[model samples]
Target: MRTRKSETELPRFGEAEALRLDAADPGHRHLFHVPPADGGRHPESAYLAGNSLGLQPRATRDELLADLDAWGRLGVEGHLEAERPWLPYHELLTAPAARLVGALPTETVVMNSLTVNLHLLMVSFYRPTGTRTRIVIEDSAFPSDSYAVRSQARFHGLDPDTTVVRLTPRPGEDTLRTEDVTAFLAAEGDTVALVMLGGVNYLTGELMDIPAITAAGRAAGAVVGWDLAHAAGNVPLSLHEWDVDFAAWCSYKYLNSGPGALGGVFVHERHHGEPDLPRFEGWWSTAAATRFEMTPVSRPPSTVEAWQISNPPIFSMGPVRTSLELFDSVGMPALRDRSLRLTGYLERLLDEVTADRPLTVITPRDPGRRGCQLSVRLGEGSARELTKRLRYEHGVIADAREPDVVRFAPVPLYSTYHDCWRVADALAATVGRAG
Candidate 1:
């Protein structure tokens, strides 16, 4: 068990300070497998790239092996005879996933990858009619989301160039302001069939105001949805309370479910049981009790499971179940408290180290406006080379976005304040060399 520290017990930027903070952190580094040093030239990497991919949990191996054993021993019977039967395997994650996102169990389901679920939800929510035919998204949205939305428009026989609205940050701004978003809705809300934005942006690490944006879009008579690939497991969410219509997220990032793990979806209860709501459905989506009856009639369940198009992938879901169990154990509230302090500590250390450098933090400084990530804009040099040096020489794992930005996400679950200090120290050295 880990000991809790009062807010006053938090430390400043230093090795001792990081050690102290790590000592008090309920989510310890031992829970993960930090990348090993290469040929003893450097220490274990100070991994600050959870924004792209999270480190694997130690328990993931055991969880997967158990499923393998079941598959070998039970054969087809594994669906109902194994320890954790594969037939209803996805149900195990529903409660924990709902807890992580602050939604009721019936409102959530774990299936498909992030973009696929978004497309699936859009099929139902993005009802582009005669006038309300536009789909709204940010200019800096992940390429996959952009493609999905644009393709969705084309699928409806609408020209994407004219029908898709891209909300961009103002002149001389790095992040989108909520005011700008609301203002766009005010002007073109009636024309928008769906308002889909990243809950936390991938490039800027900016946490958008979901409730405000959702309410604004709804007021403008548009269905609102969120792509939470970066926000889930990194911040506190109240999707139900916020009145968000639908949302989807991948588990491979902060959720620490290995790469390509199953994704989760949230469909607000208000949309459930509405027969008029258009959605794609399949056998697994029907009521389980009568699913095997193989009747031609489609009796979709009265829950979010009605959106599931196929049966659960038991192997892919094993690691996710293990990861969600950890979230359930520690809870999002405690994890979020630690994330604020850890990221704040990273910000301070970056300021101290880069005070004389040409780098600038583009991520929002306000705690409520961001998650664990801090995206720094590099000046006077190549970001790719600096990122390379940070990894090969200093053993710091950070991601570099093309042309200018380097992103560092010090996850509260396995990263330490000392890790934050090391990242800054390594970055300072790299920048000094480049200069």
Candidate 2:
């Protein structure tokens, strides 16, 4: 909550202004642990990497320990006797996760990791037949999706290079345009079997036009699915209303679960009871009431739970529950409001800092087209090296992509206005102006 004095203070841009903004609009930073600075005069690091991984909630430790203690006391009985019973532990997360992403509880389930859920959802949705064997994704998609789709192509005995269509931005553009995507589908949609893309691009931080794209893909007769790894907790979504066929998202980032936490999947109610849909199932895939029958064959539910393949790790569910509860208590509408204000402030600071520097903000200028993250591409220095200098010398925690991009996310739940000012300050100090 403290602001440092700066000799570079100007009329519109100054650390004092940042402090006043924080005093007027404080986030829920007290609920989480802001890491100690590794290298600057400031005691706390300017943590801005939530797009990669979120800070741990203070409640996570105590809540996780409680789950552990239940096991120690009740042994196998913990399955039914624990405070938050293990047998139905995942059920605790269903509605809240559903609310967070704007889906019916029957249409959502927290299950495996992000990419695993993608592959599983693809099994049921990505049905390639005849000439419609192609899968569409953006060129800047996170690498895991590229691998998943490519492997899917190969599994069907198709060439990944040809079967996977990567939509690239136009000449000199850093992000894809929705009109371009829809036009591509209009021209080439019949050849595409599935359209899967990141709801928000990982590198450029572009929040794609989900509803428009989903409508286009469906109108083109292609199944549309989104990897909301970056969009889930960052932006508001309405998968059910969007008429999306399927979607998946990881919890580790904006969801604020620990590293590699379980992910959530959404399958529209329309797809739930389709008799011909092939799904990989296990005991957990069956209805809870029928789960203990021990029958040779499974009776899968007519809900999204039918996609779940295994009993989730209860310990992992604890952190996700803790984080989702925080989201539920504060609500996405409030967080998003703060996000727009916080990110807008950061953009202004970067505007001043990069005015004479060789840095370029690659994320879209429109707040409506992006989330909490702002990505900058350096014109001279290595982004990796720039981040290192920002960290060791200035105590700013940021994420860098190889070549020349660095990402900063001013998460509304915890990131402060001072955090944004530090990013601008660090950039100015580390990357000297282009003279």
Candidate 3:
């Protein structure tokens, strides 16, 4: 039966407009494999979960196979004989990774998991002195970071609860202001030994003022570090320019290196040759030239390579190499430009959908203060339940951060304006507006 559209019904985002926008500013979606919809009118899933796990690049599988083939052909000799030699495999990643995060090649190295690298960095930087024993972190830091810092305090014979200070957002606010962080350091600087916060917060999508926070922490005599799991590839960072003391990031999220991919770390060039810094070293920690000598006493390099412990898994590093190369070819400046346009389009559609609904965008409203990820807070239904409905029912792939938040990342590398439209369209159909 034909029926007239209700006048009181909420206005829907036009599919034609979304298609028009995509035509005008076409993204590089052809280079990725977007999953088919589980259920919906469209065949392809609207993948807005890149902030959680990015879509695999079309080149990843082939490049990863080439590395595996080298091992099969050359056997033990592949270590030095392979096309891309395995002995200095990690070195292949250094320059490009440095360029991605804006650091000097000597200061950056790709290594172990995010938390493992953070622990290694803390061994050198988190030297707690008498009365200046506190370690500060964001209240909503990823659980791995919280556990890592707490254990570091306990390892040093300090009480975790008393030693680990968490910075919270102001009353009724969704994100932390730069002043909030700077003021805390100004007041409690003397008691802090380290200040480690996420460059872009995992839950809220707020891009913290990295340069300002780093400056404030250093002036207050606290060594500053960052966990860039959500920031890398999402935003362009200048770690060397910002003078961050140390930092770490996982490639599995925005870097698209697959599940539990190896992470990258940065230590300022100024601290490279400091002798008094305590580092847990192993066979690989020795300088490259001396590594072959097999001496009882190691001669560590005057570079971040000195922090490496064991020979890294060459297989894992291959995927990261492939992804970093893609970043280099495309460049962060270009990716960030597309990210702004795509994320902004999504935000506008979300505004229309959320006006009378119980949904709210918790990420900072200012485009400068966030990356491509826009996290929405559920005001009524369980986040997990709502996301499932969004997935199977509407073919929209977004992630739920447990109790309330659902993160929608309009990744510029693959996501289309049409994908963004699908998200707001899915939510409007799934969750009815409130009275």
Candidate 4:
């Protein structure tokens, strides 16, 4: 529903009017049944950290039990004999996940952790020849991504300081502008080998224009890759249609897989025929038909499965499968619709409560420019103490970045409208008390 304010009063979000969001939440659990330490009824701890780690899905437990049962019942033969056989299990996830990211099943696969997947995709896509040796990354890219790109440059016998270009926003701007990014690509096109960037910057919640960036990179003859840790599930994507060379993302965040759960990687179908693409391979990458032949030489599959280096951890993947089902049930469109409403509501509430306060939201005010997260920049020394008080006194849970930024993400699947109101109330109280 569209929101508006009357001629006199400020706009107020009507939680009751929201489209039965909680009723449709697939992962609903009885968190309120737990008794508080004070022997009072325990309220749900306004969880807004889906950008960091998602809540456990209600179905995850059963999915895990079924897998464990397969392991116990069939033993070694479970590879082929058990239902959803262990050997071909990862294949079952391919189509649905591909649909999620708007890629062909042949172009996607579940694999290692986010950082590991990034490195793997880099090995295949970041081929640096004489003239095309430089890499482009954003200045505000996540630390893990920065480290990974630096290591890739170093491994190629190139000085990271010279080979990796960190694209910064224009002076005094908090987020990068697409025009600036394109200008840089145009200026340095000939020397740039890879254009690797975060689909959504972690700290700022800036959703970079992926299709535009990909076009610039490809036009400049540079391969493009993306780290979707903060973008996947938070926004709609079309990795294939965008002609992105490759990408990787974790399931633990918006996908609601458990913390440190296995991640996925996407390699454009165009690369499937390039068997000679340099990759660090293992047995799991071998052709499934000949995999059990146990030959010494590896014959990789003709798809993204060729990127896998080892067997996936079944337990970790269980939560991924569980969480994905919830995503599938509600669908990304419905989930995102609610996400926008919830986050927009919270942003307005924050603005209202901090009318006379020192806190400022660094995240973009335009809904299309941000994810569900909002990063508030507090005054010096205020972030640390304010965050502590919110946790202990207000029954809220939010994360604080170093220096002065505090981030809160109101996940649509679990967080409610009242939670946003309470957090704003607590923040106002905390700031007032400190004053």
Candidate 5:
């Protein structure tokens, strides 16, 4: 029940520390509700799924309640007359959301979902010209991203077989090295028009070197874009400093902004004034100063908001605002420190348990090269079944990817050190049962 500083002086998480951590976690102790099953009381499960969906913060309810009350009292007038007018609601969040991704307010906006934003950004940046029409991405990118990029290429009447070049890791390797990506870019630089990549590989949890990749793409005369669905909240970023041309990410995952929450996009300041770039504009994207004039003045905002096609759902903003407020209170640096220790502890534990087993970690070993998720490869088809046992019998909620891989992410915001330990133990037992 006492507060403890997660400082260097604190003992690194082991079995006992992990247990103590679980007991002290507010999410486990207070908010989590597990139904009675098998005619018995069930303790809260070890929730390692924050990499997929974050736990709702306790304060989210109060924030939603306030907005709901305003909606009730003001009705349609809530757009301009509510406690927090919906007219500039998105603006109120721009500063904090910008800080989360290391972007200027003018360069970022929360509007559509991640994949939707990626496509929208591509409309402006992915201008394939004749021979320089190829797009580069990882072979193991999130399925949604790969589909979007392929579809984008197809829309331009280009064949993906030639236009989309997917970079794969070396034989027998699990994750890509920075040198490999840089070499590939150097080799095919002239032909590539755009480099659209996942900032963190969804399956491997490998945090791609963003600044280096952005630089390489630019040096190769390729416009760079990042699908930051996994990287946005899990790691520190300086998109503005990196000179990244454009980027997009979801809020439901690490951002904990509720299911299918509004996504965000970033465009560097250099592109803000590029009037020649193509865009699909709507009334929302028109200049705010003359938005209510009902005239066809197409003066767009001098920012990423100019990309918006329609009014964002006002209710969706509630969870994002509440979640971001929590992130602001516990800054990224402090949270990242905890994440490193927790994931490192898990890696060590898994190594100890599977020293002689066929399990191999596909995620990068370096703390700097990964977020919280750790991907483990079972030599054969052991992942799906093992994950099943962990969930039903052990109460560990890790996800299984197809073809022998399992991913576990211990999110620092809500997950505890003990959750990692429990899953590790569950993994060992699951392997034993499989054997």
Candidate 6:
């Protein structure tokens, strides 16, 4: 039962070190109930797939049950009379959501899923004019994002091939260099109507230089936006201070909301009151005071809420509210501090375990360039079969990408140092068998 070293000290490997690190972690891992291993053969399996879907918070059950009780008791009146009045329930998440991303309350809103929000935000931000008729995105962005942006270009009657500009990394590189992005924007920024990228690349787990890239895009006369699906809760963001034009993120990943939980969006305060900013509007987007009037003209609110298309889904929002409460209590600074150490520990362990194997960590080595997740590239091995073996043989859950990559995300909230050790051990065994 060795004690873990302090953050300033170097990390060591082995079960004793894992236990010590877990003991030192301020984040309460017990708050989450990890699923038992296959056939209840082992204790909770090493769940390291938070990059795809986070482990659920125990509080979510109570919160969702409360919402159900309100629905049963109040019937149609639940919208107004629920315990946390459904009508204004979304407002409860506004401030906390804003705080998670370093934005003003007025500049953020929790709403539809990630891609939906992206489309809505693009309607206003991507105003392809005569000369500036293209959108810029990273070539390795999440498939959904690539599809959304390409479809958006086609929706504007522009050809996706010529209108969608993809910025790729230099040859044989796994991640994009900030200088390359800045240079790309400098050269083609004027012709680009919008520069939208994943604040963190999902495939490689590369955290982009959002502020610097945003500044470069703006300086080049292009609107800048971000798909923060992987970045939002994984890293500390200053969306407001960065002067980013718009951004959207899903809650299911690092935020620990249930699968397909509602997403959040941020619009700078400067754009809130812009009367001429063209956006697709709906009933819920109208100002709260005049929302019930059913007026002929749609008077969209001046805040980010103006992007809403339908009434907030109370059931879906309940889990998000519960999860955000945990984030509010723990605070991002503390979570981030724990996250850096945990991921670093995992990186070191991976290097040690795979030293003799064909596994290579594609994620950046620099702490500043990545988040909790690490993408491991498998050479001369089937990533799909190895991923299955990790789950079936060792009870480790990680995600696999097509061809040859597997992603493991050690979420700060519930993941442990021991979880990192178990994953590494499982990976070593799996790779040995594959070889």
User: In model 5, what is the error at residue 292, expressed in angstroms?
Assistant: 0.4
Off by over 4 Å in 1: 1-13, 39-42, 433-435
lDDT value, candidate 6, whole model: 0.88
Global lDDT for candidate 4? 0.80
lDDT, candidate 6, 1-435, per-residue tens: 111234223224578888987777747777887877652145788888999999889889988999999999999898888879999999999999999999999999999999999999998999989999999999998899989999999999999999998888899998999999999889878898999999989999999999999999999999999999999899999999999999999999998898899999999999987978889888898998899998989888788988888999999999999999999999999988888999999999999866767788999999989999899998766778877888887788889997899999988988888888888877765565223
Alpha-carbon local distance difference test for all models: 0.89, 0.93, 0.93, 0.80, 0.83, 0.88
Q: What TM-score would each prediction reach against the true structure? A: 0.95, 0.97, 0.97, 0.91, 0.92, 0.95
Total backbone clashes of candidate 1, pairs 3 or more residues apart or in separate chains? 0
Pairs that collide in candidate 6 are none
The sequence of per-residue lDDT tens digits that candidate 5 reaches over residues 218-328 is 999999999999998899989999999999999998988888999988999999868799998998988888988988767888888889888878889988988777778
Model 6 CA lDDT for position 319: 93
What local lDDT score does residue 338 receive in model 3, on the 0 to 100 scale? 96
What C-alpha root-mean-square deviation, in Å, does candidate 2 show against the real structure?
Answer: 2.8
Worst 10 residues of 1 by lDDT: 1-10
Clashing pairs in 1: none
How many clashes show up per model?
0, 0, 0, 0, 0, 0
Q: For residues 1-435, what per-residue lDDT tens digits would candidate 4 score against the true structure?
A: 011133223334444543354555433434212112221123556666678887777677778999899989988898889777887788777877887888999999988899999998898889999889998999988899999999999999999999999998878788998888888888889899999999988888888899999999999989999999988888888999999999999998888887788898999989995957898899898888898899999988788988899987777777777776676776777767877988897898888755666677888989988888999887645566766777776677777887788889887677777667666756765664214
Worst 10 residues of 6 by lDDT: 1-10
RMSD of each: 5.7, 2.8, 2.4, 5.0, 5.9, 4.8
Instruction: List clashing residue pairs in candidate 2.
Output: none
